[model samples]
Target chain A: MDVLKGAVDFVQNKTKVEVNQRDIEKILSALNSTNHFWEVIFLSQKPFAVVRETINYLISIDFVKTDESGNLILTEKGKEFISANNIPVVKNYTCSCCEGRGIVFSEIKDAYEKFKEIVKTRPDAIVEYDQGYVTEETAYSRIALMIKKGDLVGKRLIVFGDDDLVSIAAALTKLPKEVIVLEIDKRLVDFINQAAKEHNLNLKAIEYDFRNKLPDDFVKSFDTFTIDPPETIEALDLCFTRTISSLKGAGCAGYFGLTNIEASLSKWYEFQKLLLNKFNAVITDIIENFNHYVNWNYLLPSLESSFAFVNVQPKLNWYTSSMYRIELVKDVDIKNEYINCELYIDKEAILYKEN
Target chain B: MDVLKGAVDFVQNKTKVEVNQRDIEKILSALNSTNHFWEVIFLSQKPFAVVRETINYLISIDFVKTDESGNLILTEKGKEFISANNIPVVKNYTCSCCEGRGIVFSEIKDAYEKFKEIVKTRPDAIVEYDQGYVTEETAYSRIALMIKKGDLVGKRLIVFGDDDLVSIAAALTKLPKEVIVLEIDKRLVDFINQAAKEHNLNLKAIEYDFRNKLPDDFVKSFDTFTIDPPETIEALDLCFTRTISSLKGAGCAGYFGLTNIEASLSKWYEFQKLLLNKFNAVITDIIENFNHYVNWNYLLPSLESSFAFVNVQPKLNWYTSSMYRIELVKDVDIKNEYINCELYIDKEAILYKEN
Candidate 1:
């Protein structure tokens, strides 16, 4: 069997994770598409650093070259190697109806339409709290999915942060017994409460910081909760533990979004371990690129390393997150504590700043 | 707050998993659609017994009734309760394009059409080894999904069994470097080898029972493996350990099918724990109802306790399973030895009998 030993050696040298000749085959097949670098990253689904360095190694070896548009194209040598090795260029053929999320919005079109109108007066996403909300359709899908999972009707649902305004969407359906939002942003809290009063819905938003401990009433009072957790480990710990503490007992469920752009696979391993082992929850669903976010105000000068090597303007809608649904198998008892976990300004930190 | 206290008590009494009122809310919400009993099982996604008994409790309370056609319909009391509780009838709005599986076979239609023709002479699914295979589209989807995940090309692959004939499908794509199938049924092994020889594909099949230890040549010789594991814990342990033993090392990948119909949430918990904790792997994706199976010859007398009350001829095409994708995070060391685990005769074991 033929082997690209040098490229394999380079990938191994650059990263500790073992990338064999087969792994290199994936990179070569991806480049065969001559897709944009951003699309390649989406295709490869590896850490940004690993993909970048592997591509660099391929370019140095002249197996891959870049066109004026900065897309990767396989050279003659690369094509020969791929043919010799029997590598095929894999394309994305996910369902176009729901954008491969498996959940659709047709059943809830009226509710989504009303939700689109309701969010017209919604508070804008501010960078102070690392805010970047999903499109109105995504927020609406969350409502439908929760109801489909039997998690919404007459269930006390809580939202950790309200930048997405999902709590308002949940209230619009009048499916849940109560919809509560605990927002660190006072502007969002006021705006949500104003909308609740106008629609006469059983939705309430409280102005509370994540760093502070929840009040006694808020602890152990919810049937379900949803949050787009902060990516850092410290922040994830504080937010997830707080959310777990809010659950009434076992058999409860929760939904959250995790992104590939920020968290590495190792980080994902840690996150899954935290949920399955430490908290006694089982992950039922993990749909990649399910949550589509509108480009935030902070994208112009994005974090340095995400696409720092590329000179072209980044593509939109690529900064998406996977939707995760987990159910508690056993009753959870967690300490509600204050955490001073602040966002550190790093290359992978997309939503946070020095503040 | 109005509580379905009696119903909750009945469900908690029936099961030790501690089903709460919110869990029952899911059952009530499911009945709001007045769907068939089989469809309710799909909608609620709880264990067959839990859903069945919960429905029994609802019927006793006059909240629900069955129509002449044996489909569930909400009575006046049930409708009143739902209206008062603000419960909405949740519908399955999964992407019709892919039948809610998030995968499409449009790109591989040619290969699938060819597979369709090839499988016309495929060996029949007999019950001795608990043999039932997925639909052609599902088998076809597996090939496409594996390629989409960059798991196929230039990778040495293995299939623990050949009842589904996915190995033949993979070989037809000419994507993998090598494909090996170890099936206990001699008829299947011969059939597969014949097809491989006819198609001139790099595929091999050996007749080997799962109870035997792997040969030296088969040990530690694969980049990827796929299996639809037995439902029992002992069988799962043996099959998974054997499959894991065959992996080349860490960074290797595996795919498997798990079902909510046969396996309860607790069983899924144990399965996930087995993979994530014991095997040192991380689950990357889990799409529910991804594997749609052709009704096996063993369905008329499918193990009791799964819809024993529903006297209607069992619904077609409800025996679906979820597709799970997991990757090794660390090098795995597992025992490869003869296992005495055999099929246990139980209500949950749909594929196995006292052979």
Candidate 2:
């Protein structure tokens, strides 16, 4: 038992200050009397890893013994060892808030509710068009909070493909002076225009297609843009480019919905690189599952052959998109345009290209 | 209101089949009765982004009007349009678990309690040596869960450093066939060795310095390894290389702790690339704030003069580390050795160097 001998000698001779403390005798008496070693272990705040091994070694050397119930009892050698050595006591560290997770959002519920009220009036998704609409409560909550946080209000906002109709939420706030939607769907554009006119809201909509160039009058006209583009890289890149094109200059903000269900981390990495390095944008916020779309049953019929899980038709609406906010960190080099970045990748493109 | 007229015309003719459904009449009646448009909106489950604007436009065109208290009251025109149009109702999508974050650990409490019990005997950190030990509960929880998940049981486990004494925790289970610790601290080595002998645990410890090569017998001999190295890239790289070398082969598991407090996402990206591509490992799990270290007051004295925030002595133990589990996906090439990686960047090291 040289290990125990060395530890005892170290405690007795090396830690003179601790050994001389008035609390040593009381601690020894407590340790000798306790049937449950865990109470003593807890009091000492020494980890289970260290204390268990120490106890096992001491017991092996006949310094301690276990009762019928497996509780530890100090033998004569243990009593003598305790009297000679200085025991270390450490406080238990506990945080009731996050249970040590560190990331605690205390007022998130209040905030979520508040935002939900603000976006309650937004549009319904057209299932026939592969439109997956998030619940209005979540939509309003996210958008309203962004406005409350001063991320959206007062900015000249643009909606790239306003299928989600976030422009209406922005307009209703009367926070932003102008809200415009560049929509591909004629019906939605017409519907939004009629709504804006009736409410006397500062919102307007114009028919636009991603396949075409940006209208000259709309280019670089907005201070912020919100988009819920298709997840394919080609479509995402194109919509992202259009959103960037619509921004007024550096310091502008852009919001977009991206889903992990369709876009993997590698895709996210590439997109982030494009936004950060190529476009000089800095991502400031990423809210996971900020948008959970209602059942997209129409898309399922088309996807069922490719995705067996779709046939299950579980009641759960599993599609969710994370909301991201990126702010321009440097002046936009308008000359470095990527508007023509492919909006569709051909199957032939899958083949590895020659260097 | 040409927009409203066109929308009505398009909705009536294009979606006649949906409009004729018997549910459409029930939805219209529900819409007409409720002052809360969100109810109809929810029934429509159409996202507020798309719906609100359409509603606002319809209201503007005198198709819907607000009652005395600002609640929507459908006009005769709105009633007429409702019968002729197919209204989209999107259902609210919510996850009872995780509030829609998608990752839920339901039995975390039970698992946590079990681990807490397992690690109750571990040692307190020796703060003088910059040993900011995590709570025994969390360490035990994580390690035990790993074992329960079959990541450690029946495997030869290696711990790069035994300051946390995870090797002891593993050995106590008698689950792992063998547990070895390579440590720089002599006291810990002696302490672990003694505990192993007394408990008849299959565990061993060898004192080793960071600057030296790992002993020949240990290399490529382990089925799993765990390490929590310093935050610096050089230290992390060196420690990671050593841990990788101790692994048996492909399909082996490894766990390590890294913190955002010191390592930025860019640094994480680089390290992930090295693991996924260079080492041919796949990251299986990442639990944030999985390790919460106690206050490292000893190192504060050295850092206090350099950092202004130290004077505050914040009550919260703000330091946290995320635990990562990686599994070998293929044979490790081991070509990119980091045995001599610079632990600290020297003045001369800043100069540009050609490979």
Top candidate on TM-score is 1
Worst 10 residues of 2 chain B by lDDT: B346-355
Q: Which ten residues in a row have the lowest lDDT in candidate 1 chain B?
A: B346-355
lDDT to native, each model: 0.77, 0.55
| Model 1 superposed RMSD (Cα) | 3.7
Candidate 2 lDDT over A141-237, as tens digits, reads 5564445223454557888877666677667756676888988788789877977887688999999877677787778788778888776567776
Taking all chains together, the TM-score of candidate 2 against the true structure is: 0.51
Model 1 spans > 4 angstroms off: A1-27, A60-84, A118-128, A197-201, A300-308, A344-355, B1-23, B56-87, B302-308, B344-355
- lDDT score for candidate 2 against the true structure: 0.55
Off by over 4 Å in 2: A1-130, A135-183, A186-229, A236-291, A304-310, A320-355, B1-111, B114-130, B136-183, B186-229, B239-260, B263-291, B304-309, B321-332, B336-338, B342-355
lDDT of 1 by residue, B1-355 (tens): 3457787788667643346565577777778864677677666666555676688888888988776667777889888988887776867777778888777877777777778888998888887787789998889788878878877877899999889999999998887899999999999999999999998989999998888998778888998999987777777778878888888876678888887766766677887888777887778888888888887665556643333345445576767888888877777777777878674333445432222
lDDT of 1 at B20: 58
Q: List, residue by residue over B33-85, the lDDT tens digit for candidate 2.
A: 46565454333322222233344545657766766544667788886775455
In order, the candidates keep a fraction of the true contacts of 0.69, 0.00
Best by DockQ: 1
TM-score of candidate 1 versus the correct structure, residues matched by position: 0.89
